[model samples]
Structures are given as structure tokens and as C-alpha cells.
Target: MDDVAGIFARESPYLERYVQLGIASGRVLSVSFPDAPDEDAEVDHELLDRIFDYLSGVEDDFSDVEIALTVPTDQRRALDRVREIPYGDQINVETLARMTSGIDHTDEDDLNTVRTALDQNPAPLLIPDHRVRDGPSAAPPAIEQKLRSLEGL
Candidate 1:
């Protein structure tokens, strides 16, 4: 997974780990959007185009590729606000809705909002469940002793 931000590739610690694992295991291509707001009306067509271009270049390495979009919980309200916008030719409402509502899995309000967005845009959106990585197997004895001493203070 290559993270392209504003037409330039960027580094993300979390994505680096994920991509490293995926590439090593020869898993399907999975691209994620970690910090993009849900209601971002302009879908960053340039970024998407670049991503697709990159994907096309790598088509031979992986047989299948998928896109995963992540949005913060706070961005739902912004999506609601987007619905009220005039949404001139500058934006694609369907794509915006799909990207925004892709990972909404909270309560009735969120579900309804997601449903509405999906109803408006029936494309399948990838929503990844947050997975916690296991920490180090064991700490050095000296480090453990230091931690124990600190706990007693």
C-alpha cells in the first residue's frame, strides 16, 4: 500500500507496518485513508487518480486490490453538513457518500446516516475493523525490575 498525500507519497508508521505485513505475506492490495474527514466534498481526484495509476503499475504483482477508507467519528456531522451543500459539478456526491459512510458502525443515528449514504451510492465501500497489534513478547529482566521499582514509588 502506497500512501499518497496531495499527489506526493507520505510515510505513516501504522500503514508501514500494515503494508509490510501484507506485502511479506503476499496478501491482496489494501489501501487505507486514515485521517481524511468523511464530509470532504472534494474527493481528491488527483490523489485517487495517482493511487489508481500506482495500482495499475503494480497490477502484475497482485491479482486483486481493494481500497479501505477510514474516517474519524467526528466527521459524521461534517458529512451531514455536506448533504446541505449545493454540490455543484465540483463534487461527486455518490463517491463522497461512499467514501464517508464506508466505516460507520456505531448506533442508530450513524447507521441511518450510513444507510442513507449507501442508498444514495450503492457501491461497496471497504470498512476495516480496528485491530490491535500484540505488544512485545517479553521485557528484559532489567527493564522489568526498573518498572517494578518505579511502581513502588
Candidate 2:
């Protein structure tokens, strides 16, 4: 597997934040925070539409949208668990660690591993890392909070 940091640095460009009225279920897809440099970058119309719909209200489902997030193989299980987190709910690190404990055939989902998986999550809303929090140290805290507020949770 590739190094997580290297993957993030290389794949940063593809990560986009966009919103479309009737396109993506009124959801927003962003790689970073609104104020980040990549915020104003151009994105595909279809993708924006999907993001809009996904973030809209209750009809957002991105199972059809194909996205690639590169991380260590061990983290895949935890990331999948992160994605499984409901749109309007959040989970703490300990809980996530417990949930994903046996996924990798070992206790690889310790606190630090889970934290790294979340912090390096390439797709935020798609994976919904904002829903996982353990205090001010959660990955992408500001963006996570914004997403949670958007969901009215």
C-alpha cells in the first residue's frame, strides 16, 4: 500500500467541493474547508449536482457516484466503517475503534490508527468523517462541525 501522506499530497487535486441545486441531491462535495485554496477551483457539473442532492435534506445517496480515496490497506476497514456512519449521527474514536476492531484481522484500529484514517479521509461527506469526533482533536474539526450543522444534528 502507498503511504497515506504521499497519497493525500498526490491526490489532493481531485478532491473537490461543489454544490448543485438539483444535481447531487443538494449536497456539498469538498476536499477541504470552504476557505481553502481548492474551494474556488473548477469542478464537473454532474459532480456538483450530486453533491447538492447528497447534502440537501434526506434524499441524498451517493452510492452511484464513484470516488477514489487512497490510504493504507489497513485503514480501509476503518474508513468503510466511517462511511457507514449515518448522515445525521456522529461517533467517537473509542466507539469507532471498537466497531472496526476485527476488520483487519487484528486490533489495528487503535486510537491512533482510527485518528489517522479519519484525518486522511479524502472524501469528507462521502465518507462522513465529520460524524466521528472525540473532542477538538477530530479530523477536520471545523468542516466536520459545519457538515453536522448542515445535517441539523
Candidate 3:
């Protein structure tokens, strides 16, 4: 665990752990809660401030934060719906499936599709995968729950 403990670690005074972010081409590619703080993120200074604001419990408009995702149309649709979820509000997997696929009721296939999309999400917080209850995300489950608790409308 010591060797690769901080592949995605970012130093923050607000918390004991790290909040690492990956950025490229004016878009955040990834965010992760690694076990420790290691390398410093090198990206836009503005985005760094925004991330710090978020870490400090400020409900900044993450909707405007740019993110990159190269996925199929269906996955993009699911991620788009995830972005629309209210800051503090949470939706169920079944509901997300319905919202994305427009099925009368949610089935395993629809739910799985949504799950796959969420799991494949390159950008979690910007896309707000934590806003979806039981939704899969690249962020750790603990971090997802913590984000849900911290963010408010």
C-alpha cells in the first residue's frame, strides 16, 4: 500500500486525506481519494482554486466545471442525466435508468446500462455521480458518501 498509496493524492489543509485531480485540455479527466498525499497536481490555477473551494465545503457551481468523457452515445446520455441531478439531491439507480433510457419501469438491463455509464465516468464530482443513490462511481464509496454529506443546494 505504501508504494502506490498516492497515485491520485492532493494536499489539502481542510482534510487529513488527499483529493487528487487529473486535468488536461481544459477539462478534468479524473478525481480520486488516494490513501496519502504525494505529487502535487499541475493544472489550471483557476480549477485548482475551485477544487479547494469544494474541499472547503463551499457549494460552488460545479456544473460549469468542464470535464472530458469519450463514451458511447448511451453512456453520454446517462452521464448527462447525472450532471442534472441537484447538488444535494440523490436519485436511485432505477430512476436514473428510467431518466436516461425512458423506459416505463426500470429493468436490470436498463439499470445495468446506467451503472456501467457511471462506473465508466472519467469525471465523478464534476459529473456528480455521488448524487445518484446506489450509483457506481470512480470515486471511492466513502468519498462519494462524504461528498453527498458535504454538498448542499
Winning model by lDDT: 3
Which tens-of-lDDT digit does each residue in 48-128 have in candidate 3? 568778877777657777666788777788898888887668888878877875543347776777888898888777888
1-153 per-residue lDDT for model 2 (tens digits): 121111111112222332211112233323444433333344445545555555555456455544454577656778777767776777887788778845432454466787788777766667777777662323355546656777776
For model 3, name the residue pairs that clash: none
Q: What TM-scores do the predictions have?
A: 0.18, 0.63, 0.78
Q: Give the alpha carbon lDDT tens digit for every residue of 31-77 in model 1.
A: 33334332322343333443344333321211133322134443443
Instruction: Please list the residue runs of candidate 1 whose C-alpha ends up more than 4 Å from where it truly belongs after superposition.
Output: 1-49, 57-106, 117-153
lDDT score for residue 125 of model 2:
68
Give the top-scoring candidate (TM-score): 3
Give RMSD (Å) of candidate 1 vs. truth: 18.1
Q: Which residue ranges in model 3 land beyond 4 Å of their true spot?
A: 1-9, 13-15, 36-40, 101-105
Collision count of model 1: 0
Off-target runs (Cα >4 Å) in candidate 2 are 1-30, 34-43, 101-109, 135-140
Which residue window of length 10 is worst by lDDT in model 3?
A: 1-10
